[model samples]
Target: MEVKKKLLDIVRDTVRFKHYSLSTERTYIHWIKHYIFFHNKKHPKEMGKEEIEEYLTSLAIKNKVASSTQNQAFSALLFLYKEVLGVDMSEWNIQALRAQERKRIPVVLTKDEVKLVIENLKGIYNLITMLMYGCGLRMNEVINLRVKDIDLGFDKVYVWDSKSLKDRVIPLPLKLKQRIAVQLEAVSELHAKDIKDGFGAVYLPYALEKKYKNAQFETKWQYLFPAANISTDPRTKIKRRHHILANTLGRNIKVAAQKANLNKRVTSHIFRHSYATHLLQAGIDLRSIQELLGHKSVETTMIYTHVISEMNKAKLISPLDF
Candidate 1:
């Protein structure tokens, strides 16, 4: 079989199985293409374990790709052989040189610094950052938030299909509830316009679109932070509203951070780090914080313990102590 045809078939099979996101499919295909091209367009099936090993070694020794990038390539190839090609890759061994692990702590903005950053941001950008710190949400989580996910009356925000496909709820600040209510009204108006323009479909995950054909058109299914303009869906080619772009938010965050004169290197994740540290300072349990952050492991949450310990170490001792 031609390599391109075989590759397309593999991607189709992966998509049919609904294993992961469309983004994953595109990335896997791109890496596989590069692998094939690197070997002068030789068919992957004609290559064996020795060829795979050489390719991975070249990534480390010649290409000098980072450990994570090499790992992603490994995963993509593994999926191709095992899931797509119907061959087990368990017996194959190809190791890239592992990168050194760094112990650098996450940059955390002080509460006052956070306040300054928020104050510098205007309009919707300010609201988004407030939610990031207030709820300890990742930037993607904030962007993907839907009207149905927020429980204003209960003062909670539900995060669904988070990293690792897990769902968790975090407390919503009461002060933000009124602001969110106002935002929802604006969302409703925008939704109405989309409906009027005959573009009332929502983006659903895989086969869910078929199962719930009209679900996307509903108010509850609307994105809480819809993009400023309606755009055609790349996959379905249907006109629909998607969430705000990460780059747009990222640029706004950089400007806000600079205006605040914060010395720390601040980004969206910094708000999340600050949120966890603040919670630790306020005596929140590690496990509880882990749940709120949707962390799969308790060890991931333990990073904040060092922040609390350092704060404790800074206490002033009595001058006349015996």
Candidate 2:
């Protein structure tokens, strides 16, 4: 038990040293622990590609996990072997029975539907949704926004260290400029209160806190959408204000969708999809949309073309209608 405990501790340290988010660190730890337990608590150094394959194949066949979930599990074990254990996984050539990946178009809300959903959402959630649809932000990207990321003078919104490290900038939506200013004022007031209470530090990414000793305590470094209360940081154990939970944003969006009486499935990502699709429909060039959406490849952005094509075809009159 002590050996397993120490192994996880080392994994956590490695993940932190690499500057991975807390959510990612937790996920990696969970999968690594599960892998060890699956093999009857055998240390990962004792196992190789064969044991890894057995565990992944079982996820597909026994647990019936999705391809992405299985892939995440695979990545965790790969990190454990290569990073933590100093083993060369390049030659492993894992051939596990892979879970099937589905090719489905993203569910996008219509412009009017977006307005309805926004109307149903209250306070910060409303502004967050607008930013997601306006800037094609992922849930994490918007929720993890820092005060320094928004530039009202330049009318820009900067997204940093997003999924796959795709950092990009977006034009600030003219409609939401006032709302953002109001939000900034609220954050400033809250930050002052926290400092008065002797707790004003915010979580800085990676080694930034070390480099800039006072950056974590600065108002610009604070979360743009902070949580209602200061809490203990799980990693550093520092009492600080953190950003709003992603699950809270997602849950509120779901509730707003239900209240809006929209039939199609709604998720935080739906707004991003809508943002991309609406840009395409507005005759925005594929390359420009790709850049705005911070897609690493044009091919990933091409999915919006299919969505628009399908939408157009759905508009065609059937024989009965004719």
Candidate 3:
């Protein structure tokens, strides 16, 4: 009989089997290891609900972990006990720190400040910043763009399998047509060079690799923002250029914000906030903005209303006028 896999290996197999994202898998494993180590390397199978509570309380009291981090640990443990270990944890009273509810308005850029920020960014970075502001793409949405996902004729960009595993359509800005074509040509050259080096396959999501034998080699599925160099895939050991990391955009935007001398905190997400607020300023209905922003509820999109036009202005009537 084959020996049963170790705890971490079993968790890995379970996460992959459920098609969780790579980041999520890493996070779950990290928390599981921490839980075990906190209890002096005790196996999870030997522990029960009380041990889980003690570990979580230690995090809040000793480590002083943020409410969000505490909750993440809770969720990771919940998944481990319920899903992986086949334990019934629903009856366990989890007394972890609750995440504080925050209601701060999102930061929005004026039209001209956006123009200044865009002007400071050059080449591919500029195009990406434009998409963030112009089309309301999340940072991951832009980085993971495949060549086949864009349609210039219809002026739309298809954002696929994004956060919450929901896909939506974003309108392509007219100004970006020529710029995107140039970008495509540059990417084509890079791809050709990669092919020459016997390394041109890109990662596919949800078993597309099994569905289409040559999907990896097809340029249609290639990352629009291919990385500067190829690297070995952790799962398949194939060398392919993944999309440029999202941190590159954050770092470049910081520099650009400094160069523009803007006094507000600026990040790639600011562009997305600006996208929603600007639309609201132009009298776009909440429902339309909700759909464009790909928010599951109109309430999430309504936050922009608090930041735009008359909603933000102070107009107190004078007693003398009365």
Candidate 4:
């Protein structure tokens, strides 16, 4: 009989089987590696609850990781034991280190500030920034958009397999539609060029490539924001174009923020934050905004109410006036 494969191999297989994102697979594998190394490279099968507790404690006390990060590591380990190892850890009572109460608020930009930042950004970055802020889309959601996802006829963007594993249609900003149309034309030309060069293939998720034999060559499935050049797909070693790096897009936002003379910490996700807060200020219904943001619960969307309340000066009476 053939011997069983290694633990990480099994973890990869399990993650793929469950359709977990590539980022999740990397995170799970990273935490699992750290757990094994912390215990002198002993196999996790040799470890138990007490050992797991020790590792999580080390993360909080020694590593000084945030509460959310610590929780992620804990979840990774739990998944490893339960799913990969088939270990029954139902009685496991590992308590994670709790984060201190933080009264953190989302950083929002005034209309003028948003305009200034957009002015500072140029070309593709400008369009990307506009999409996120205008459509209230998260970074991953915008970057993962395909050519077919943008419905110019209906003036809506179709978001598939979003964070909540649900599909949503968000209104397209009329102002940006013309620029996006030009972008589509450019992409069409590029697709034609790629096909002439004998490499028009694009990737699909969840084994869709195997399901549809010639879908990869179809323009509809192409990435709306394709990379500058073709690169090898790490899993299959096939050379194809992928989407622009999200990190690069984020860095461009930071540079533009600085150029705009904004003092607050403006990130790519800040665009989404501002979107929700600004809509609340406009008196849009909370439930409607919740659906647009693709949030599973209205409670998540209600945080924008707090932001708008803080920004609204009408409710406040200053002691200095007295």
Candidate 5:
């Protein structure tokens, strides 16, 4: 028990040293704990590729986990061996029975449906939806937007450290420019109030806190979508305002969808999917869309092509028409 606790402590310290997100750190820890416990609390140092494979296969066969979930566990184990335990996992062949992958199409809304849902949302939620559809932003990207990220003069929105881990620039929608400007003004005001109350410091990613010294207290670095009230930072125990929770954004989207009476399922990511499909339907090339969406590969962006093809199928005439 003491050994496992000490190992997790090392893992936590290493993850923080590497500047991984809090959520990612937690996920890695969760999977690592599951792996250790599944093998009768055997220390990961005593295990190898075969044990890893067995555990992953159990996730597929017994737990019925999703393919992504299985991959997540694999990554955590890989990190445990390579980063924490300091073992060479490269030579060991791991042959795990993977969870079945389903190739279902992403759910997308029509442009009109997007409008309908947006109409039902108010204030920040409305703007969030616009950015997701207009800029093809992931929910995290939208929530993580800092004041400095918006280039109002240049009509650009800069997405930094997104899921792809690649920073990219997206064109700001002309219609939402004023809305975003208003949002910035609101954020600045809220930040000023927080500072006057002696708590304006926002969380900085990675070593930026060490590098910038005062960047955490800067208005430009503050989250554009600040929480309504100040909260305690779980990691630092600092009383600071964080960005709006993903759950808050997701819940609002659901409520808006219910109000809109739209038949299609709606989520924050559905807007992103709609954005890609809409761009494709407008004859934008896949490469341009790939860059705009910050996709690492054009193949990832190519999913929109399948969506387009499926939509076009509805327009095809039956054999009787020929």
Candidate 6:
């Protein structure tokens, strides 16, 4: 089989398994292509554990890629071998690459700095940032939020299909309820316009479009942060509503940070870090904070303990001992 034909067949088989996102599909294909090129156009079937080890070592030693990048390549190759090519790699003993110990702390903002950043943002961007800090939401989660996912009556935001395909409910800050209400009103107007223009389709996950058919067009399924105009779906080539672009929010965040005179580097995820740290400072239990941030493990939530310890060290002690 020709290499190009085999690559296409492998991609099709992977997609047929379902549940994979377009981003994952694209990444997997790109890495697989790179792997083939690295071996001087040798077919992956002709290569074995030795070739795989060398490719991974090249990624670490020569290319100097991060551990995560190498891991992504490993996963892609594993899928190609085990699933696409129907080969068992379980008995394979490939040499492992040593990953460096990264000790970089996440960038966090002080309470005043968080307030300053939000205050500098105007309109929709302001509301989005407030939710990021208030609910500790990831940038993608905030952008992918749908109308029905928010339960203002219960004061919780349903994070559906999150990072790990897990769903969790996080508290909606009472302080931002009114702001959310105003944003919802704007969303309602946009929803009405989309319906009138016959472009109300929402972007469904993997195979849901085939299952529900018109569920994408339902108002309840509309994006909370809808794009200003209709655009063609890159996969289906159908005109539909998509969420706000990440770059748009990214640019606004940079401008807002500058206007607030915050010298520290700030990004949308900084609000999430500040949210977790602020809760820790307020004496919230680690377990409770874990649930609020929708972290799967308490270990993931433990990073905030370091921030709290640093803050406590700065406190002035009295000269007189008890």
Alpha-carbon RMSD to native, per candidate: 3.4, 1.9, 2.8, 1.9, 2.0, 3.2
| Residue pairs in collision within model 4 | none
How does residue 266 of candidate 6 score in lDDT? 93
For 54-120, candidate 5 gives per-residue lDDT tens digits of 9999999999999999999999999888998899888898999999998888989998999999999
* Candidate whose lDDT is highest: 2
Structural similarity to truth (TM-score) of each candidate: 0.89, 0.96, 0.90, 0.94, 0.96, 0.91
Q: Which ten residues in a row have the lowest lDDT in candidate 1?
A: 93-102
Can you write out model 2's per-residue Cα lDDT over 52-80, one digit (the tens) per residue?
99999999999999999999999999899
Return the TM-score for candidate 2, rounded to 2 decimals: 0.96
> How well does candidate 4 score on lDDT at residue 133?
95
Residue 104 alpha-carbon offset, candidate 5, angstroms: 1.9
Local lDDT at 205 for model 4: 90
Q: Candidate 3, 119: how far from true, in Å?
A: 1.6
Clashing pairs in 6: 202-216
| Cα lDDT of model 3 by residue, 1-322, tens digit | 9997898988888888887777889999999999999999999999987788888888888887877788888889988988899998778776654455457799888999999999999878988899778998889889889998888889899998887567888888998888887777788888888889888888988777889979888888888888887888776688789998888889999999999999999988999999988898888899999888888888888888888744556565578878
Q: Which candidate, 2 or 6, has the higher TM-score?
A: 2
Q: How high a TM-score does candidate 3 get?
A: 0.90
Candidates sorted on TM-score, descending: 5, 2, 4, 6, 3, 1
Off by over 4 Å in 3: 1-3, 93-95, 309-311, 314-322
lDDT of 3: 0.86
Clashes of each: 0, 0, 0, 0, 0, 1
